[model samples]
Target: MTSKPLISVIVAVYNGAKTLQHCIDSVSNQTYLNKELIIIDGGSTDGTIEIIKSNQDKITYWESEPDNGIYHAWNKALGHASGDWICFLGSDDYLWKSSVFEEIIPHMIKAESQGTRMVYGQVARVTEDEEICCLDGDSWEYTWRGIIIDGIGSFAHQGMFHHRSIFELYGMFDVSFKIVGDYELLIRVFKEGGNAIFVNGLIVTGMQIGGITSNCVKLVNEMARARRKNRLRVITIPWLISYAWAICFPFLNYIIGERYVRYLVNFGKSSVTYLSYKKNVILEHKNDQ
Candidate 1:
């Protein structure tokens, strides 16, 4: 019998004592056999270290120390990973089910056969109360356009699996990006013609909202910077409008009140969705030819 490929699940956290155990439990309880869990803690003063100590037997590797940012912790964890495939999970994120890895293994094999270095599925974006806001993720073509033209990443990074060769070829995440390092890394790979396969039937992860990625101003700024760093144009109409909206949102919320601002935001989103639908039609036609 052929051995199952090893998968390394890395979690980078800082002062996330409350949700850390749930995250660890989700990974540790995976039905898949060939997997390792690595945790990198950024010197938490909270009870996070104690939780790590408690779960030491289940964890393959763990370290607690001050770090620059999420990407820095992720980069440090990368050095310790010994898996055929790697995935990053947030302390507030958890696998959707115990059987998720078991289910995804076949897709991983398919991706490997096709020379696709990245495989991503959907993630449930949930409120703090665990009510799901929406399912996040899309096809690679849409994701590519979202990252390149819209200054946004349509997929959740938590839902992604990276082949070992991706790191070997493209290097690691850029620590310079505070809010959008994951976006920058994806942009870097896709720009260089790296292939990604989308797993349509699975929702791989459940992520709680209101993380650092929720900071609108920081996220948009870092996204624009990431596009520029990846040698992609950031002055596209969609990006310019997104930047303007991010810059004005706080003031608009304060002046017009958040309720009305949300109404305006929703209207804007509807318009963007229509535009995206139109663009997708064009892309589909091009693909058919």
Candidate 2:
């Protein structure tokens, strides 16, 4: 491993043979050379293991075997990361283009120099056939109205880079969450009063269809728990408005289906995620999942 890595990219897989190789390749092509990648598999019986082994040289660090879920794999990856910055890009997701981290790293370092706790950027959705859609881009703007109510949009665990110290101070991913563990982790970052900045530039491929994160019900439940964990300051209007948005998501997706919903619902989600993105890294397995 390089003694001075600018970023550590972590990809967690559980039987994701079809997409795992593409995800790994995306990391290998990163514009940033001073990077290390960690692949933690969840006891996959599929060819996913073979694909990883084929790319063993590119994988700076990796592990195979059963794990609890995405967060568990992520927790394992964290221990092996030796970079100044960290992020988890899911097995099914890949950055849409090359040099995915190029636009954002300098800005992240600048903000970190100013003593900011973290830096987060925008994300877009990539269809199975590879068409792209924006979640938070030139097309949208989101603001945080209230603490608990802000999880409405599509800021993925993939879109942001986190500071390692934030995890040291806060704690690690809570495993109790079945779908929205990442959301719960964000709230903990907020409660700790971590400093962060929203980058106008975008990063990573996110807001995809068919992923566990695409489920509105799962998102709602995770947001509900995240709010509880943070002990929201007040029952703000955003919280009340969120209930309306939550109710509409399922029916909207059913009618519009996954493809169009990315352009529709994710606009607010990506913007909201900017305000809502966290600085926390996992410290313990308080997984309430």
Candidate 3:
């Protein structure tokens, strides 16, 4: 494996005009230059095409057409990718730092040489008001613990990088799964005896409070289906509770709004996380001197 393998950064979006430019600019400004940016738009009409057009130089391949859902658009982007390695980023997400790829490539090369096919990193969650919170901590370790537990730890797609061959081996994501396609793919990879590397640092910051996946009922149903298809024993307790909440959360959210819900749920944690990260940044800067 080369030190700087070509990495394909695929973004799947719909009506994401407002946040699309940030996503494009982050990839374009990456310190690791050997990458292709592919955008799959699901027939967006809200000025998304213009945003894509304005950033033509940064985008290697892009197309806008009606698709089944996010996973279908992801499959389209995968078809267009020409790089040795691939990673999917949401249209609303971006690399956490300009040097993220530079920090990640060596680990990937090492993983590849050791027969590992996928690599994942930590992600930060960014709120609508721009407050940042690290997803790393006691709740999740940067290891295959998530794979072992099957569905316990964080397995967000935005922070994962994949070697192109995994796709050939596992086939494309189950587009039938509107929300848990990434999890389904991960389960298949592990089931097939493929290995993955975990990079213990933040690579991307994805929007935390919205998207179709936020619909708890759909997510729970799709996850149960994936587990069953893999012949794993399914648990119904959490699913039942989630279904009950999902029934009422939308109405409560409509009355209280997302920002309020987020505030109530995340109250003290986000502030503490923000302060800790700021302190680390200052310490790193001072040590550089």
Candidate 4:
């Protein structure tokens, strides 16, 4: 990527009139110079398409007809994308900041230049009241632990920005699964041994503290599907240990959902402590200098 690489930021929207403007401005106001915004709307009846059309000039490419679901809409957006790397910013959610990609894209290019096949990043949760919280910033060392164990996390159409080749190699979002496509996609990518890199930076912020996914029951169901997909995804699990896990872990979450929440809460709390320690260390180094 010699010249500036164009980042194709795809947005999948469905009746998001309230946050539609926020989502649009978030991408449009991005400090990144070379980029394109593709929005896939699911035939919204609430004037969402009108609002999106009003700013059609700003949209690189878009379609406002009904789609199967979020991942299908995302796939449509991807098909329309014409950039070296593709990232997703959904209608319900927006980027953490206008300059996030500006700061991260160069790092991606550098990583790719280093012969890395792809990179995995992190995401934050935008609570119902609009509180922006980082998944990995607070005591959350193993942010992807849920993904590692139950096969789901804050990743979805968010938390990652990978090269076009990744989708080509692993294939696009699995439309068969509704709520678990993102988890399924990530599991496949990881199992494929894609050049994955972890960045502490905050990526997209999920805006659904009050939504279905924000709730516990729906989330567990989603996880179960994701786990099943993972088992089917990999040719075989490593030895009987993982094979047994692949069979039983999905059901374990139901018994331990409350425990899982407690663990994540503590994990998030601990991340805050670690962040403070690192910040103080940097400041101490500067003061000594």
Best by lDDT: 1
Score each candidate by Cα lDDT.
Answer: 0.83, 0.69, 0.74, 0.64
Judge candidate 2 at residue 72 and give its lDDT.
83
Q: Which pairs in model 3 have colliding backbones? A: none
Least accurate stretch of 10 residues (summed lDDT) in model 3? 136-145
Tens digit per residue, CA lDDT, model 2, 1-289: 2233378888988888999888888878877778888999988898888999999998998889878998888888888888788888888887656766776677677766777666777666777776666555322223232333454433456777787876787788888776777766766776545456777656556545668866665566667766666776434334445556767877888898777776766555444454443311132234533
Query: Global lDDT for candidate 2?
Result: 0.69
Q: Mind sharing the TM-score for model 1? A: 0.89
> What C-alpha lDDT does candidate 3 achieve relative to the native structure?
0.74
Candidate that would win on TM-score = 1
List residue ranges in candidate 3 displaced over 4 A: 133-153, 192-194, 236-289
Report the lDDT of model 3 for residue 191: 54
List RMSD in Å for every model shown. Answer: 3.4, 8.0, 9.0, 8.9
Model 4 segments beyond 4 Å from truth?
133-157, 203-206, 232-289
